[model samples]
Target: MTPSARRRVPAVHDALADLRWLINPRRRLLPRQPLTSSDHAPNRCARSSFVSETRTPGQASDYEYVCIITFIKEASTTLRRQQQLADMDEEVHGIVIVGGGICGLATALALHRKGIPSLVLEKSENLRAAGGSIGVHVNGWRALDQLGITGELRETADNVTEFHDVWQHENNKSVVVPVRGELRWVKRKDLIETMAKNIPSGAIRFGCHIADIKPANPGSHGAILTTLDGSIIRAKALIGCDGGNSVVAKYLGLSPPKSFPRLIVRGFTRYPHGHPFGPHFLRLRCNGLFVGRSPMTENLVNFFVGVWHPGGSVTKDPIAVRGLVLEKVKEQCSDEIVEMVHDVDTESLIVLTKIWYRPPWQVMFSSFRRGTATIAGDAMHVMGSYIGQGGSAAMEDAIVLARSLSRAAGSGGGGGELCEKKIGAAMAEYVRERRLRVVRLSLESFAMGMIWATKSMLAKLACQAIVAVLGTHSLGHTNYDCGRL
Candidate 1:
C-alpha cells in the first residue's frame, strides 16, 4: 500500500471500533466520565489504567483481538481530548443578548418569564447604572409591570401628580397640567439592579466586549460573535440591546443615532430635611435653554439642564461642566431652581452628553433583522429624552421581542431547521410590531428637539400652535399598552 493508504488504515479502524463501542449494550459507563470539566484529566488517566487490568491471560499479547482493544482505547482518549479543546474554542447559546443595561436585563427577565433561557454579554465590569436617573412614564410602568418589577420599584419613588411648565420667554407664564397616568423618576441604578435580580444567576456575563459580529455560515440561522478575548460565541438568536453606538446596529447597517446639538446634564440632589416640591414634574423653558426637575422621593430630587451648543461640544471635566451648568442655569431659571441645581450631589452629576435620536425615516425603514439576529432598545430606536419615552420605549421593545420569540419557539420545537426558520420569522414579526410605534415617537421627539433649539420667532409660534391644537394631555403615546409577555 502507498504511504497515504497506510495512514488511512488506522483511521478507518478507529472509526469502526468507536461504532462498536457506541452500539455496545454494556459499555463501561463508570470509566467514561464527561470530558467537559477539569476533573476529566484525572478521569482519562484512570480510564487508561483500566486497559491493562481487562486483559485475557489465556490470549497471547500479539493476538489480533488484544491489539484491536488496545488501539480502540488509545483512539477514544485522543478523540475525547480533541473534543474538549474544540469545546473551549466555541460556546453555544440559545439566545445571546449584548448589553446589560435596563433593556438587556429586561429582555432576559422577560424571556425567563416565558421559560426561554438567554445569555447576556456586558462589556462593563459592572452594571452601567451611573447615568443618574431616568423618567418612567405610564408606558414604561406598564412594561415594568409585565416584567413583574413594578411593585418593588414603586417603593423607591412616588408617582408624580402634576406637570408644571413655565415658559420664561412668555413673561414667566406658568401652566399646570395634571398628570393623567403614572410618572416616576427612578434611579438608573435601582432599575438595573431590580431587573437583574429577577433573572437567573450566571445568565449575565460581564467584561465580554464584542470585537466583531457576522452572520453564521450559510445554511445556518443566527450570528457568530467574537469577543475581545478571542472567544467565539455561537448564538441561535442574537439580540443587540446595546445602546446608541451599538456595534450590532452597525453590523445590521444602521446609521448611528444623530446628535441634536443639545447638551444635557442630569443628576440628583439630597434634602436631608425633606424637599418642599411635592409629587410634581417641572419644566422651565427659558432663553433657548431648558431645565427640568422632578421629585423621586420626599428628600431626593432629580433634575436635568439642557443647553443648545451649536457644535454639540461640551467640557468633559466634571468641575468645568458643573460650573457651566450653574452659569447657564442663572441666565434662564429662578432662584429656587438655580439653588436646586447648585445643591446637586458632587458624584451624582452624570457627564454631559448631546441629545441623540434616530430619524423617523430610519425608524420607519430599517430592516432591523438579519436571519435570527435583531436589535432592541436604543440599538433599535434611540429617541431623544424630550418626550420622556426613551426608557419606556426600550422596555416596550423588550416585552414585544420576548413575546414574539416565545410564540415562535412554542410552535416549532421539534427540529433544528424548523426552529431556526421560526426564530427568523419571529424576528420579522417583532420588527413589524415595533416599527410604527417607535416611528411616531422618533418623529415627535425630532420635531420637539428642533422646536427647543430654534431661535426663530416663527418657529416658536408654530410650535405653540401645534401644542395648542394637540393639547398637553392629548399626546396619547404614553397611554400605549405593550401587552403581556
Candidate 2:
C-alpha cells in the first residue's frame, strides 16, 4: 500500500504493455516480447545498494539474485517513473491537435494557459471561412469568456439583438421580440481571426494534413501520426477538431457525416449606408421556405433561405443562385423583404451547400472518444444552426477538453504512461459532461427546423404557441456554464 510500491507496479505494468504493442501491435494487448537491455535502463541510482549495508563483505555474489527477486517490492516510485521515461528515444510531443479551426485553436490556447505545449496540424494553407455567421447566446458567450478572447471580438462584431427580431407569420402578421442580453452576429472569418490572435504564433503549421493516425493503448507509448508530407510525429495525445468530414473520424471507425434534409443558400450583403435595419432580427416564410436576415454591422446584413429540396443540388454560381432565391422570395414575401434582397450584390460571396450532420440517435449512442484520439466541434456533434449554438458548443468543448487533460497531467507522474493514463481520464470526463447537453441541443435544433418549415395552419398555430410560451429558455443546454478551467 506504500506510494512507491504502487507507482512502481503501474510503471512495470505499462512497460510490459508497451513491450506487447512493440512486438505484435495487431494482437492488441497480447504479450509476445520481453524487455531487453536495449528496451530498459538499469536502476543505477538506487540508494548505494541496500544489500551492502545489511550484509558482510563476502556476500557480493548473493547481491544480484536478492535484488532481482524483490525488485518490485523494493524499488521507489520516483525511480520507477525515471526508468520508464529513460526506456525510449525522445521523439514524442506532449500534445498534437488535428485541424486549425476555432475549436482546435481554442483548445490549444486553453492548454497554453496551463503552460502545456501543443502542435496543431492544419490541412489548409490559410484560415478557413466556410460556415457563415454564428450566433452565440448567453452560454456560448461564457465559454468564450473563459478563453478571454470575447472582448476583442465585440469591437467589430454586430449585435443581432440590438434591433429586435421581426418574425413574420405565414398569415402576413409581424411580431417583434424585444432583446435582452444581445445575440452577436460575427462573420466566420472575423471570429476565426479573433481566436487566432490569442493563439501563440508558430504553434500551428499550415498545409500539414494528417494522412494516417495510429493511436496507442492505455499505459503504452504515445500515438503516431503520418502527415501528407510523409513526416512522422509522435504525441502523448491527439485531439480531433477537423470539422464534420473528419479524417480522424474515419480512423476511429465512427459513422460518416450525414446530409441534412434542406437546401441552404447563405451570404452577406454589404450596403454602404448600413442597410437601415439597425438591429432588427428580420425573418420571413414564403411557400414553406424559411428566410432569415440577421442584423450585422451598420452596413452589413447576413441572410439565408432554406427549402425542402431533399434531393436538389445547390448551384455553384453565386449570381444565379441569388437570382433564383430572390425570385422565389419575391413571389411570396413582402415588398420590404424583396427590396432588402435587391440591395444584395450578385457577385458577393455566399455559402451554398447541404449541412451534413449526425442525427441525435447517432451522437447520443456514439463514442466521443477511442483511445487517445477524441473530437470536438462539428466533428463530434453536428446539427442545424437553427439554435445558433454550434460555435458556443465548440468553445465549450475546447474548454472542457483542455480542463480534463490539464487535470490529468497534474496528477503526479509526467511520462508516456502517465500521459496515457491522464488522457484517458480527461477524455472520459469531457464526454460524460458534454454528451447529453448536445443531444438536447440537437433535439431543440431539430424541433426548430420542423417548426420553421411547417406550412399547415394548425401546425403553425401550435408552433407559435410553443415558441411564445417556451422560447429557448426552457432548453437545458443553453444554460450550461462549462464551469472554470
Candidate 3:
C-alpha cells in the first residue's frame, strides 16, 4: 500500500475511537470494528443493535466481544457517497438562493469558490435597480475582499474620504465635523452589476417567485420550495438574501418587529457646475428631518431625505411624493438646496419605507438548517440601514456558513447519520455566535436613527452640543470584526 494509504489506517482508527467517545461518554476507549467496502451504504448497513459480551471458553482471562455491524466502502468513497446521499436525502439537487441583489450574488460567488453550485432566483423579470444611491462602509469592503470581488466593486464605486459639512436648517447653520475612516459611495445598480459579473449568466433565474418552502424530508438538511408557477425546486440550502419584504421570512413565519416612525425618499440628480458640495465628503443637513448627499459619480449627486410619516402616509404618485419632499426641503433648507431638489428628475426618485426592530433578533424559522436546507442574509436578520451594515452582515453570514459546511465536508462524516448531526450542530453554533452581534448592530442602528430623527429642539441641541464636545469621531464606526467571518 502507498504511504498515504498506510497513514490513513491509523487516522481512521483514531476517528473511530473519537466517535466511540462521542456516542458513549461513559465507556473507556476501545478498538473499533474493522470496516470493508460493502458495509457503508445508507439503509443497507445493519441498524445499530444491542451487543452483549461473555467470557471466551479457551482463554485463561475472560474477554468480551460484542457484534456491532456497519456497512463500509472505502473511507474516502464512503465519505463522498454519504455527502451525495445527504444531498439526496435533503432533496437538495443544488443550492437555490432567492434574490439577485448584492447579498444573493455575493453568497453565490462564495459558494462557487468552495466548488458548490447554486442558482439565484429573482422575483423581477428584469433587474430593476432601486435605491438610487448607497454607501459601502469599510466593513462592506472587507466582505467583498473575502469573496474576491472587491477589486471589481471598487472600480464602480467612489471612495469617500471625508465627511464634515453638516447643514442645519433648524438654525441655518453649516457646522463642519471631521469624519475619520474610509467609506465608498456608489450607485446601487453598480454594486449589483459588479456582483452579477462574477456569476455566470445562466446562474441567475429571474421571474421566479417563491411562494412556499418546507422541509424536504423528516430530519433532513434540504427544503422543497414551491414557486409561483407551481414548480417545485429542491435545494440543499435556501439563502434568503431577498430584501426587507422577504417572502422567505414570511413563508418561514417570521414577522418583522415595528421600530421606526419615518419614511425615506432617495434619488439622484446631476450636479450642476459650481455646486458647493465637494466630491470627497458626504454632506448631511438636519433641519426638521435628515437630508444627506453623497457623490454617486463625478457628475452625479445622490440625495436622500427622511421625514416622519405615520405608517402609509406617503402618496403613491411619484410627482406628489417629489412635491412633498420638495416642500420639506424648502421649509428647512436654503435656496441652493431647494434649487437642487427641484432639478432632480422626477422619474429617477426612489422612495423606500423605513422600519426598525429591537435586539435579541429571532430567525423566522425555528430550524436554520433542516435536512439539507438553510437560510442566510436578510431572510435571517433584516435591520435598518442607518449604519449601513445590512449588506456587510449578509456577506458575513455567507462566509461563516460556507466555511462551516466546508469544514464538515472535509471531515470523513459528509452527510450521513453522524454528518447531519454535525451540520445541524454547526448551524446552531453559527446562530449562537452570530445572533447577539447582529442583534446588537440592529439595536445600535435603531438608536442612531432615533438620535438623528428626534423632533425635540432641546434634544437636537443637546445632540449637537455632545457632538461638538466629542467631535465627529463617533459618527460611523461599527464594532463588528468582518475579517473573522
Candidate 4:
C-alpha cells in the first residue's frame, strides 16, 4: 500500500460504516472485499465502491469479517458522534435549505405553501438588505404570485412603466423599449424583507455558516451539513441557493463561478419629492461600459455602473468608489448621464461588486442533482445583472425546486424504502426543467455584455434597432412563466 493510501482510507471508512450492523444479520448483506496493503496507496480506491482484487474473498474469512465489521462500526460511531455535537442537530429536518437569499427565501415560502416544513439555514446574521436594487421583471412576478406576496409587495413597490436606453441612439436619445409587461424596482433589502414575510417564523436560522456537506448515512437519508460554528444538520433534501460560490454547488461538483474583467458600483439616490429620470427609467451603453438607473420609488432612484477593471477589488472606500463610478459614467456617457449621477448623496449606500458569470454550456450539458442535494439560482446559473433576470431566475428556481420536492414528498412519505429514489427523481426533474432556461439566460447575459462593449457602429446600430422596435419591454426576455404556484 502506498503511504498516502494508508493515511486516507481509515477516516472515511470510520465515518460511514455502521457499527451495530456488524452484529445484525443485514451486516453480511453489505458486500465486502479483502483490504490489501495496497488499499493504503495514496489516492487509491477512492471510488464510491472501495474494493480490492489482490485478495480472494475467502482469504482469512474470519479475520476479514472482523476487520470489515470493525471498520464500519468505527465509521458509524464517528458519524453519530459528529451528529450529536450540537443541540440543534437533535432534530433531523425534512429538508434543509441553504442560503437565505431570494432563492432560499422563496423556496421556503414555496415549500410552506405546500405544507412542507423546512429549515432555512442562513449564513448572514440576519436577512441581507445590502447590494444594489433588483429589477424584478414580469416573469419574476409570477414567482411572487405563487409565493403569495406579489399583491402586498406591489402596494409598497414602484412600478417601472418605461424603459429608456442611452448611447446607441444619435443626439444622445434614449429609446424606450415597447415591451408590454412592466418591470418593478425594489431595494434589495426591501425585496428580501417581503420574502421573509412569508417564511414562517422560526423557519430561518440566521448566522449559520455551512462549512461542508457530506453524504448522509445510507438508510438515514438526506445530506449532512457541518457549519463553521459547529453544528451538524441532516435533511431529506439539501437545496443550494447560497450564491455563485456555493458550498453546496462545490460539494456537488459544479465549477467555480467564472470571473469577468468587470466590476460594479451600485447605490440609491433619494429625492425629497421626486426625480425626473422619466417613467421608462434609464439604461446606457458606453463603449466598453454599462450603466443604468431606475426609479425604485417615487423618491428613490437606484443606479449601477459597470466598468472594465483588471484589478480584482472595488475601491475599498465608499467615497472613492462613488468617485470612480461617477468618473466612469462621465467618461463613457454623455453630459446628460453625468448630471444624473451628480446629485447622488455622498453617504448613499454604495456597494462594490466584482463581476462573475456562470458557465452556461457547462450547466446545459451536465446533470444538476446528486442524490437529494440540488442547486438553484446563482448557485446553479449565475450571470451578469444586465438582463435584470438574476433575481427573477432565483425566484423561478425556487418555484421549480419546490414543486419537485413537493411531488417527491407527496408520492412517498419519508419512508426508507422509497425516500431516496423518489426524492432523487424529483431533483432530477428540477434539473431538467431548469437547465435549458439557465443556459439561455447565462449565455444571453454574456451576449448582452459583448453588445455593450462592442465598438462597431453598425453592430451598435443593429442592437438599437432591435431594442427600439421591441421596446426592450417587448424584447421577449421577460417572457417567462414559472409553472403554476
Best model number under TM-score: 1
* Candidate 1 deviant stretches above 4 angstroms: 1-87, 415-418, 454-473
User: Residue-wise lDDT of candidate 4 within 53-95, one digit each (tens)?
Assistant: 4554323333345666677687799988876665545457878
- List runs of model 3 lying over 4 Å from the truth: 1-92, 165-180, 272-275, 280-287, 356-372, 412-422, 451-476
Give the candidates in order of lDDT, highest first: 1, 4, 2, 3
Task: Pick the lDDT winner.
Answer: 1
Query: For candidate 2, lDDT tens digit of each residue in 40-76?
Result: 2233323332332332222222333443435545566
lDDT of 3 by residue, 276-348 (tens): 5665554555645677777756667777777776565566566677788889888877786677778886777
- Clashes found in each candidate (C-alpha, N, C closer than 3 A): 0, 3, 14, 15
Task: List lDDT for all candidates, in order.
Answer: 0.82, 0.71, 0.63, 0.75
Q: TM-scores across all candidates?
A: 0.80, 0.74, 0.70, 0.76
- Two-way TM-score contest, 3 vs 4, winner: 4
Residue 235 of model 1, lDDT score? 95
Give the winner by lDDT: 1 or 4: 1
Per-residue lDDT tens digits of candidate 1, residues 1-485? Answer: 46576355643443444445545656633245232212222223454433332223222222234545767798899999999997889999989999999899999999999888899999999878777888888989999999999999999998898889988899989989877689898999999999988999999999999999988889998799999989999999999999989998988999888877777787888999999988888888888678889999999999988887887357777667878889988887778888998888979887656777888899999889988889999998887887888889999999999999888878896642227788999999999999999987887777787687778989877765655554423556788899989
Q: Which ten residues in a row have the lowest lDDT in candidate 2?
A: 52-61
